[model samples]
Target: MTDLASLLPGRFGHLVRQLGAFGGVGVIGLLVDMAVVWLCLRGAGLNPYAARAVSFLVAATTTWVLNRAFTFRGARPEAAHRQWAKFLAANAVGGAVNYGVYAALVSGVGFFAAVPEAAVAVGSLAGLGFNFTASRTLVFRGA
Candidate 1:
């Protein structure tokens, strides 16, 4: 397969590569988010809203670990716990946007209420750009 970065303009190749890596990590996080939400709802008998909150935290943590290891490996090194905290804080804005869209869909749409994972997918896409930018500039700033 042709490298995605090679298809982009030279000036943007590095950024496109990073975005591709981030997007790959995000896809894993989305799967994690959907699974957690489904399990919480089906196994634990939690409400959709509560399940989503739990799932978001789990997914965010998963993405943070993966992004640190793969997406932004050159990120400034810091204490692991401290970096994790920073990652959470920086992503909160994107998370709120993500959650807001999810909440609206689940509360207002019957289909989304019945299939919350679908809502989760939509919400994740909504927040993708914001999350990528915040993560890159705020949480993972380095060479």
Candidate 2:
């Protein structure tokens, strides 16, 4: 019998490495989202919630491109656009969950005054697993 690892293509290892790299990309996107949300609310006069929604869109889009290029490099070409749309839809759910969690952590616990970044981090981390799983299964289903 063949080894399970050998059953997969050579790029399987590369895909795993790319997952780590895409995670770094996600981190950058998160920073951009946070900065934009903060600036829009605190500096630009937009409503706080509005700023967060807008920033989330921008960040999710950025992550999608990086993920397509890196994490799922072996994804099928014919379904690429459809996969991206599904990915974005899944991310919308994740983004909403993240925003809700952050809002609760900030308002319910009043952590914003002391550590606003902590709230964002906690929220985003909570949503990360769900997002990844859904994106892999529903969006970029390689099988």
Candidate 3:
């Protein structure tokens, strides 16, 4: 089967390629996040919110490395520590947006009230645009 990005043409091509790379990396990060949350809740017997906090950190770190290496390559190189900090700062707004959406979906919608994970997925997507913009413009502007 043809790759999904192959469907895009013209000015959107570069963005589509970047977005595809980011998305692939994001999937890996999501797996890490979910696994950490599961392990913290099940193995460590942590509260759900506490588990989520830890999982978010793990996922953010993973995504930062991957995004710097692949998705935002060609950008001016900064120190690893500095870049990581910038990544964290840039993503904070996105994180808040994600959480707000998730909270609203789970608490305000009857359908999502019964299936919270679906709300999580929707919330995750809600921040994608802002995250991409911040990563490209504020965090990795040299590219």
Candidate 4:
């Protein structure tokens, strides 16, 4: 099968590949977020808002690890702790956007309140562009 990068023109191919990889990582992150939220809400007896906050942190950490290992593997190296911190700090805007969407959906919509994972998915997508841009430019420059 032809590679995805080859299907695109010039540097756009590389960007497309990066976006694909980032999207894959984002899927994993969404799963992690959903699972964590479910566990927090059900097992830990937390409110939806509180569960979402906990889940977001967990999911962010998960994505940072995966993005470092796979999505932006070609990026220049730094201390692990430092890079992780930078990743978190750099993606804060995206995280806020993600959380705001989730909070609004869960608070305003009965379906989302009952099915928080669905809200998580929506929030994840809402922040996808911002997260990818921040990851590529600020957290993982040159990748």
lDDT of 3 by residue, 16-117 (tens): 888778788888998999999999999999999999999988999999999998988888978889888888887889988898999999999999999999
- What is the Cα-based lDDT of residue 70 in candidate 1? 89
Candidate 1 local lDDT, 1-143, one digit each (tens): 89979988974898999898999998898899999999999999999999999998899899999999988899888888887888888778887888899999999999999999999989988788888988898888882
lDDT order of candidates, top first? 4, 1, 3, 2
CA-lDDT, candidates in order: 0.89, 0.76, 0.88, 0.90
Pairwise TM-score winner, candidates 1 and 4: 4
Quote each prediction's TM-score: 0.75, 0.63, 0.77, 0.76
Q: Model 4: what TM-score?
A: 0.76
Q: On a 0 to 100 scale, what is the lDDT of residue 5 in model 2?
A: 46
Cα displacement (angstroms), candidate 1, residue 83, comes to 1.6
Q: In candidate 4, which residue pairs clash?
A: none
* Candidate 2 C-alpha lDDT tens digits along 38-126: 88898988998899888977887788787777776666664656766787799888877888888888887865747979999888886
Of 3 and 4, which scores higher on lDDT? 4
Q: Model 4: per-residue lDDT, tens digit, 10-86?
A: 87998999999899988898899999999999899999999988998899899999999988998987888888888
Candidate 2 wrong stretches, greater than 4 Å: 1-18, 78-81, 96-126
TM-score of model 1 (CA atoms): 0.75
